[model samples]
Target: MLDCFHDECGVAAVYGNPEAANHVYLALYAQQHRGQESAGIASCFPGDDFIIRKGQGLVSEIFDQSQLALLKGTIAVGHNRYSTSGKAILENAQPFVIQYRYGRLALAHNGNLVNSDELRAMLEHRGAIFRTTNDSEVLLHLIAHCNEPDFISVLRSVMSQVRGAFSIVLSDGERVYGLRDALGIRPLVLGELEEGFVMASETCALDLIGARFIREIAPGELLIIDGKGYESVQLLPKLPRTAHCIFEHIYFARPDSYLFGHWVHDVRKEMGRQLARESHIEADVVIPVPDSGIIATLGYSQESGIPFELGLIRNHYVGRTFIEPKQSIRHFGVKIKLNPVKSILDGKRVVVIDDSIVRGTTSRKIIKMIRDAGASEVHLRIASPPTICPCFYGVDTPTRSELIAHNHTVEQICTYVTADSLAYLSHEGMFNAAGGGGETFCSACFDGKYPVEFSGMDT
Candidate 1:
């Protein structure tokens, strides 16, 4: 089975813009890293004629010249998805658009609908025919089947019926609808472009098209944007609490993106410093696992008074090699992806800092290569706690039996990785570094305590 580091999905939408489809395409490209399995876009022209183009591939691959030419509209919604709750298939691809009494509606969604199984069963029992197993189809069914008079009323009715994390964007060729979860499990932000307004999963997507960050869409808020600007409605009254995903800061989000008023890079660097403080070791140089761990490794070096060195040189042009279809080509994949700088590693005591270890396949390969490069001693320091449990939210994590940390103690894990010494950041330390102040976080993957009930889940 593939490692479970699932993505929560990404959404992009724009209203009152002549080139709305192009803008949404750019936003989705900015969020391509979030979901690579499938991409789609649906647009509603001024005449209420809807155009939708969807396929099972990346945004660039699906939105080719012929498809883009067919999707003509001034209001649009797009989705890039990684299968978190359902099987990966073309039918499960997102931007589930359909015709309704209100007009042609194009819907793109992020996050999962926890109560979808029950809702789908109820809808199916009521004579609703299903087209796909994707949870996004549920929202479309509700919107199209709603007896409510206005579009917003139909949306409100649908929102009230669903439960769990959802950040949705919809358009009826005239207005764009933006909605958030009752608990805010995923991130959504609004931005203003010269032509009109935009909404996306992350701020980085907004920056792609010169959109100025307006603010984060609050939990339980439903926002509508058009030529006149935007309006907000409180769909579900705020609960007494919030449980945002902490892994977004630790590993998922882009380092340059900010979430919940916290800078992601700053949080990661702080975690590295915290890790260094607890796992201080006498090493000649501190090395990072290329791009993701660079900031944190720099923090560790700064805090520990150790020199930071680029002992490992990553192939900048190499796309993620692990996702290649052929397993036969994966054994020596790291060699093509990363190469050690022999001069820096030769006869040196090096401390390698990585974000987290999953199956330990990549770590083992890296350790062997470093040793082969003549490093006298190798110490592995991880910035996050061990991932002992699977993440059902969106991350594709291996089952408990597959995770090395789940079966091995720290010493055993160190020996397995062939590291001279190994240490992981304490869970509490990681939380503090991520700006936690005793607030509840979804640490299910690291601690086996899911914030929400999962007994009924297929996970």
Candidate 2:
């Protein structure tokens, strides 16, 4: 659903490609689905200073041929952002560039810092100036003020102090660095480019740039690329348990990407299969909500022995519908993005498959649209379990009071959406579909068992 929770950000970097900025731009474009609020690229040459260009817009809107031509370097880092911590402003865009004792550094971060307020206050008291309210700026101050003698030591010291999910990419005019938090609540992967090494939030970005897939950057791992190629360092002792965010498999990640060693598309399809087994209903046709639901809908149709049809068509050209006329129109917001296929739904009992439902408003509008198109019955099947709590790590989620699932039972939700029936995949079913036991992934949004304690922070 377009009204669903938003992902944090996407990070992309190249260590040795001469046209590093161009490659990073392509990678960010491929991972644009992760975040759309802002886009940026920071490049560094061997002897030259960091070249940075960032703005509050899409990659295509921010960078043109001339802009790319100006960013000359063999090392680059880029970010696509949807704010989870900082305000939506130009200064909050990444990769944030700074000059410290070590040298010029550019950093792009994905995920929220639970202790950012505490860290920021400490830094401020010590006379550290901040240019942006972004939690990412705290890292720069931490690294700059550390008493450690070397870059690697300073990074390790800084990582040990911060808490919460962080998958970061940093460059110091020549070398590129990648790091993941101890719990690995966010995703980051390493890839091999023809000219050098690449790192991104997802493998889809690497595929777009024709890079070979390398393994995921392990939890608490630090990867550095310089003249000596890539060097991996274990920054912290492996935690007893890791909190791999389960939502990545259910939503956030691109279907083409591999996350947690499983192809995202395969996991989603399995979730649909599991949903079919858990809740089987006889229907004339199975239809997906389009885009996000396409793979899962296919699995639902296959497992249930029902024919799958394109019952909804989405307008690819429409950017997010952020505005509506003061004079209300019937389902005006949804109508701008999606239209139902009358011939396919006419007089048929349709099973509608969707990834998840945040609030009942969007689902209700979609169901009503199907009904108006002449559908006899509308049965809603969600591939993932209901999201009952807000996520603090990275995802921008509605408060618990705003969540329909948190406030209403499944039967009540069915009534609220005016669907003939509604069913969501069970927590166990989701775990199985994701190819990991319950212990391996974080299901805090579904079960309210946060792996990391935010304490006084407002999530």
Candidate 3:
């Protein structure tokens, strides 16, 4: 799983819209790249009960015209999930709905809670019954068990008790609620639709439904959308510091989306510029590893004054069903996904750029493919710092032992990947390009300085 980092869940909610479910479906479809394991939507009518429909698959595969039509309501919340805290099972599919004294509540969460085990244990001691293994379920129990006078007070109390990253969207059959963690490890944005207001994990989702971009749901901020319009509450008065995940700019978010007020594509291009400044290579042509590497590769070419070429063509049709051969097949996995353009690579000194190298297996295969295509030289340049540590907030990463950078030195990694030469952007370079020298971003996977402590919650 570490060959490529998996994105966390994506959450979208719409309030005061006649076609709430339909709008949410379109938003989820736009953000489906964030998660593909499962999809779900929960809708609440003005005076009627909440309806739920969820299944394990892509958004399109799970919902049809009839299914979306059946989920009629004026308010809706939806989730696309990739498991980070629980197994890939139907039971773990999100937009978890529960009926309690407060009425039907539907919740969709986009991050991991480090204190989940401790919280679940405490809740269970007080006789809480759980139906799923997901950590997001802990929030439901916390909200349900609080003996506060109103829902907002109870939500405030629950927010204070939990720790680690969480960007949640929930509805209690009346209003839609959105909350971002104090550290802002995950992204949550607010948008405006003609029919109503909307909240989503990325702005691309907002664009899909022709929603006007509002500001992001700030860190430690709670957002409420209802017939009364948007309302704000400060959940956590102060956070130690901001720790916005820098990887969102590197790989996770769509290039067209905006993250932390910076255009994702622009940030990636700047990263490539920084990488080229730090490690410039003389070569015949520069090529990206396809899709994720395209923008960075363009920046590298522009900055290095080299011609850019599509030396490798990716087969966009490859899906999850492309299973690996049982027997040892040479580069079968990478082969199924990509192939080198012999015409472009033959007799060319190629410079290959990629966002990041995780396990190094895929990089090795790609280098070999270029070599086999008669490339005279392959100089590898990475757009970001070496990913030496695994991410724990939400992105699914391999263990430290599985990371190539953690186990091998740069020179050794270059040898392992069979590259003529290799260089990675420095931490300072990445910070300069993405954060503009601000220390508000989290580079835990590159620096191993986790913003949150997970000492007692490892189980």
Candidate 4:
């Protein structure tokens, strides 16, 4: 079963590479964890018509050898989308391509725009026809309708209208561009490929294509790359305080990635160590909830001096949709997705480490499964603080009323999850271990301090 929190999106672009589309496919595959809803790629040689391919499926399911071969070009841009602002439909699949005065433009965006509703209404009033419900499309409209003298000027004008988290990659058939919001609420990095340059949502995408990590795109920086080379311009001024999404370290990003000026794996391990220090229980063995929880579990085991064990195994082949029989099946899907190791958990005082508890339903079900597998005592340790608020940036989360921690105390959550003891990493521990002060990162999901105010937007 997937966690309650949904990932934002992933983006990649390659310029000056003969196999630009192929490299982008590999990049999207590496970032499949970030999104599974839809995938797309657009490519073109300098002064050529763009070839665009998009589908409502996984990256592997959407593209194959023939499709990649047909996307012949030395420049490309790709996106893997998990929509937070739009309905799931073919119309909403990204790499949103359009023909305008500048010829062809394709854009893929990875964050939510808080003022998109107001902007959309304004645009519609001005006879702007809309295609998809996603806020990302608004960027394309803004760029197309700008009265600026040049492309850079157009970008600066558009950046002023949109407000919120955005890490976007776009192509105009000849060049590739990458940019992040002024507050830097998301991750975007540049990489050096042997034949070209790469920009993607994470360094892991670069690693998969054998590209060398260069550096993270600075907040408000816009990077433009073409056959000649690449250059950067600060289209938007840096705010007094930057707000990098902290969930990237806790659960959203791949552990192998380096994000927000720190190694994601190192930051996660530190969170686990800090959790161990905050809440310690006498237990026989420490077991992780599998995959996402494994790294932090190592740190917990190291600090707690408890032997680390892989008590839960996950099946990765599960898709977003599953057919149910006429009769409802109880615990069948959960078992198929994650199964506990009886040998490791039987007759032992087991401590289970997980990323975070959202609705508490999955955590409850998992705890029940562990007990059924013969664990005598189960203590649950969460790697991050309780999610008490909704994220307005990019994460798809339940409302505040739906979040268990919003209404219940720690003792109540423990009882609801049916755990002997439950503990979450403190907010201070998480921020400190992540190596930043409150001004450097966004903890809106934890503390409800939104860096970008909703009602304050220009109307």
TM-score of each: 0.92, 0.98, 0.97, 0.97
1-459 in candidate 3: lDDT tens per residue?
126899899999999999999999999999999999999999978757889999999999999999998999899999999999989999999899998987889999999998899999999999999999999999999999999999889988998998889999999888899999998989999999998999999999999999999999999999998898999999877676788999999999999999988999999999998888889977999999988899999999999998999888899888778667689788788888889999999999999999999999999999999999999999999998899898889888888888899979999999999999999999888887786443589898998888888864222
By summed lDDT, which 10 consecutive residues of candidate 2 come out lowest? 450-459
Clashes of 1: 8
Off by over 4 Å in 3: 323-328, 456-459
lDDT of candidate 2 over 321-394, digit per residue (tens)? 46888999998989988999999999999999999999889999999999999999999999989989999898
Better of 2 and 4 by lDDT: 2
Spell out the clash pairs found in candidate 1. Answer: 4-396, 4-397, 5-395, 5-396, 5-397, 6-394, 6-395, 6-396
lDDT of 3: 0.91
Cα misplacement distance, residue 20 of candidate 2 (Å): 0.6
Q: What is the clash tally of candidate 4? A: 0
TM-score of 4: 0.97
lDDT of each: 0.82, 0.92, 0.91, 0.91
Q: Across residues 1-459, which tens digit of lDDT does each residue of candidate 4 receive?
A: 255699889999999999999999999999998888999999989888889999988999999999999999998889999989989898999899899997789899999999999999999998899989999999998988898998989999999889989999998877889999999999999999999999999999999999999999999999999867889999898789999999999989999999999999999999989989999999999998887788899999999999999898898777677776767767776776898989999999999999888899988989999999899999999999888898889988888888899999999999999999999999899999999969999998888888899884221
Q: Give the candidates in order of lDDT, highest first.
A: 2, 3, 4, 1
Residue 109 lDDT, candidate 4, scale 0-100: 93
Clashes of each: 8, 0, 0, 0
TM-score of 2: 0.98
The worst-scoring run of ten residues by lDDT in candidate 3 lies at 450-459
Q: What local lDDT score does residue 6 receive in model 3, on the 0 to 100 scale?
A: 91
